[model samples]
Target chain A: MRVLGIDPGLTRCGLGVVEGMVGRPLTLIDVNVVRTSAQLPVAQRLVTIEKGIDAWLDEHQPDAVAVERVFARSDVSTVMGTAQASGIALVCAARRGLPVALHTPSEVKAAVSGNGRADKAQVGAMVARILRLDAPPKPADAADALALAITHIWRGGAQARIDAALAAAGRRTS
Target chain B: MRVLGIDPGLTRCGLGVVEGMVGRPLTLIDVNVVRTSAQLPVAQRLVTIEKGIDAWLDEHQPDAVAVERVFARSDVSTVMGTAQASGIALVCAARRGLPVALHTPSEVKAAVSGNGRADKAQVGAMVARILRLDAPPKPADAADALALAITHIWRGGAQARIDAALAAAGRRTS
Candidate 1:
């Protein structure tokens, strides 16, 4: 299954695509950020983000999508922006009829670094090690996106099967 | 300034654009949803979303964008979809260099209905009453989007001043 992971943000939304089979190694297809200028108004910034994401989605179509859940309590504005960013990712995936999964930062960190409380550097190192990349993914955000994808790949098998079952049942009921 | 509020979703992303000056009543320019079917791949869904948003932005040219924050905890899949939807909305604003703001559901409810715990119907009624509309905005989601935009308009003036100050300081330092 191919999975697209996203770390959503208003200024810099990170995206990573990975492909894997149930019992095989995962391959990294792409990683990048959809960035916006802080100087711009919020509406214009959103336009840039929409276009960039559209281009990326067109270029690398994945079977499923995964995104980090934002749960910050400190800054309401930041949390709100993160939530909006997350919504955009969901809309993009759902429009395509691709199934989506959400993982918390801790869940991704645990799956990647074997510790939920692992720091960014640790998670980054582990992701690079697992992907056998010559260098760590740049801009912490990109690494986080990759880790999210990896986590989904590790746990997505059973979920996919369950979804398939549910879909079949729904079809029968309909 | 005009603020566009979006309630992002996979199947139906609600959009409401409201124009207002600092001390004047807000005007609702438009409200609608860009809907897509579940039969398509994720990539096609994203394309549909991009086209819808791009067209909206081009027509409205909003100064800022506001979106509803998702806080559901029930289904992981649903949350993931909502997050992605939010991401798309943010990207739409960011691409156009517009400043984006987000408001939690509770915050928007409070702003519109004078109670954070108000239900959708109550909030919708209040929005219609405040905007002096002959009918409540349809699709519940559309009303929520309008409420979010109003909240941003109410709060954005001071926030913009603060952002401007920060930008000036950063420019001097750089």
Candidate 2:
């Protein structure tokens, strides 16, 4: 399945598209980052993200979307912005009736690098090797976004099935 | 000016509409909460919020929008959801070219209750008294939403002007 991965951030949102299936070689369809000026108002920054996301969804229609989940941070301001960006990504995917998956940072790291505590350089190196690229994607966020997509393609389907089974067994999760 | 205040949440989003100006009596045009089942997928939950916000914006056609600013809390999951909802509210306002205001919980309390550290009960009481309602709004979220509107009507305009000036001076804030 073709999957779009998003590393949601207010100032810089990373988008990566990959196409593949279980036990199949993955193809990097595209990778990009949409940026918004901090000088702009909060609402306007969101508008920029909305437009970029809308355009991406239209141009590169993916079967599923994967977003990095935001958790509480010591800096409330930072977490708030990340969560907002995540919300925009979720809305974009849902509007098209695409299945959305949220993977925590550690999950994505482990999926791509086989190490939950892998540093950024290590994760980037592994992503490059996995995709057989000479160099890793730039701006870290870009590679992270790709990692999220790869993780979703590699693991999300199985997890979804498990969730479905659990729900069937009357142990639904939010 | 007519202001629409949103207390953003995943399960229960509070929405309130008020009509008035600074240093004047305010009128409560409407107050309501939009709820979504936790059983739904995260993306679907966001879609529900998006629809609710879109409808409110369309129906009220408010001159401005005010939303509660989310902060870091002990409950990471809860804060994440709240922040995401805040992002949706900002987008709903920005899409329509309506200026948006974000007020912190403390700011709202200070504006409505004359104390930044006021408890929810105190804020609720003040909201009811300010709007001349028989009692406080049913849910605390509903009252908080109204309080946000009252704060914006009474304080946010000046802050926006100041921010605009700062931006023009090349000292913009995020």
Candidate 3:
């Protein structure tokens, strides 16, 4: 399954696409950062983000999109922008009828590094190892985006198995 | 000038359109609330809001858009959604190249009711008095939306005057 992951932020939104299923090796399709100048009006910044996300969606056309869930408790000044950016990503995917999932930062960290409390360096190292890249993606946000995509693929596959098993059990009972 | 005011929320987004300039009787062109089911996914809910705001912009063709500025300190449980909704509203207006202004609740209250800390009922009553309406708009959100529009007109007029004066002073000094 192919997946696009978004590490949402107003200043630097990270986009990463990965193609892989649970057991197979993953391939990094692409990674990009959508940056907007703080000098621009917030409205225009949002428009820039929307357009960037739309272009990415058009090019990748992933089966599902994963966005990093935002929490208000994060950096007070930036949390709102993060939430706003995530909203744009969500609506952009939904407009095209693409399935979207939100995963928390810890969830992404745990999915790749086997530790929810892993530091950024650790998470980046794990992502590099998983994708067989010689070095971790730069700007940390890009690596986080890749980690989110990897998490969704692995978790989604496991959930699908559970769902199929439940359906089989229901059929037998009927 | 006609202004489209939006009170951004995921469940019930209030919209109001007011037309007039400073020191003139403001006319209420329209007021409505866009309600989205809580059961709906966040992405779909955002899309609903985007469509609602878009339709209002298209119909009113307002000279400017006034949106209530969202603060993270207000209602921790709902602030993220509020910010997201506001973001969608911002993008909708920016995409059309329509000037957008964000008015704080206190600013709206002060402009309409002469009190920065005015309660909802007081603000509603002041809005009704300013617009010459028999009654304030239905929901508190609706009234707040109207207040935002009124505030923008008044403040925008004052700002324009200040700019004109500054320009004249610059020319004299030059």
Candidate 4:
């Protein structure tokens, strides 16, 4: 399966695409950032983000998307922006009829670096090592996105089985 | 100045544009929704949002944009999507060099209804009264967006003064 991972931000969103199957090594397809500015109006900024995501999707055509789940905290403004960005990603995935998987930051880190508390540098290094890249991914967020995709793929098998069991159980009860 | 307000959401984002000076009654230019479906892919949904925002901007040419600040307390996946959508709005505005303003939900409620704890209907009714509209804006989110813009215009005067003070201080120090 091809997975597109996104790290959403107001000014810059990091995206990574990888192709692989369960229990197999993944191939990195592309990674980049969608950037906006503080000076621009909110509507225009939204447009830029939308356009960037659209272009990426058209170019990569990943089978599935993995996004980092946002945890709420203080800084209401930041949380709002992050949530909006995440909504855009989900909407984009839904628009294309593609399945989406969300992973927590700790889960992604643990999957990539064998530690949930692994820093960005550690995670990047580990992603490069796992993907067997000649160099680390450019931006740290991109690497994190790649790690998120890999983590989803790794965990997807068990989750699918559970989902199947749940569906079957529902059918029997109904 | 013309200000665009956005109530960002997963399926439908409410948008409103108003034009006026600070402390003066504002003119409503437009109000509408940018919608996406669950069946579409995440990337394509972003594109739809971008196009919607761009079309609004092209038609209205608002000088500034205001968006309701998000606060996510539950649903990690949903929060992430909301953040991404908000980021798209920020990016769209920034690209156009229009200033972006953020308002908390309470701030907007207080501005429109004089009660921070006001419900949606109360706020919407107050907005219609304040703007002298024939009726309250349709869709609670749309009304909220309008209130957000109005609040920004009202609160932004103080922000301008603060900015001017800082500028003067810098000049004196220099």
Best-fitting candidate, scored by lDDT: 3
Candidate 3 per-residue lDDT over residues A60-167, each given as its tens digit: 989999999998888888888888889899999998999999999999999999999999899889989999999999889999999999999999998999999999
lDDT of 4 at A129: 91
User: What lDDT tens digits, residue by residue, belong to model 4 across residues B97-173?
Assistant: 77887788889898778899999889889989978899999888788878877887777876788999999999999
> In candidate 3, which residue pairs get closer than 3 Å at backbone N, Cα or C atoms, i.e. clash?
none
**Where in model 3 is the C-alpha error above 4 Å?**
A172-174
| lDDT-superior candidate, 2 or 4 | 2
> DockQ, per-model, please?
0.27, 0.69, 0.88, 0.40
Stretches of model 2 off by over 4 angstroms after superposition: A73-77, A157-174, B74-77, B156-174
lDDT of 3 by residue, B52-153 (tens): 999999888999999998887888899999999999999999999999999999899899988999999999899899999999888998998899999999
- For model 4 the local lDDT of residue A42 reads 50
How would you class the docking of model 4?
A: acceptable
Output the number of the DockQ-best candidate. 3
Ranking by DockQ: 3, 2, 4, 1
Candidate number 4, chain A TM-score: 0.87
- DockQ for candidate 2: 0.69
Each prediction's TM-score versus the true structure: 0.58, 0.89, 0.98, 0.67
Which whole-number lDDT from 0 to 100 does residue B114 have in model 2? 88
Better of 1 and 2 by lDDT: 2
What RMSD value applies to candidate 3? 1.1
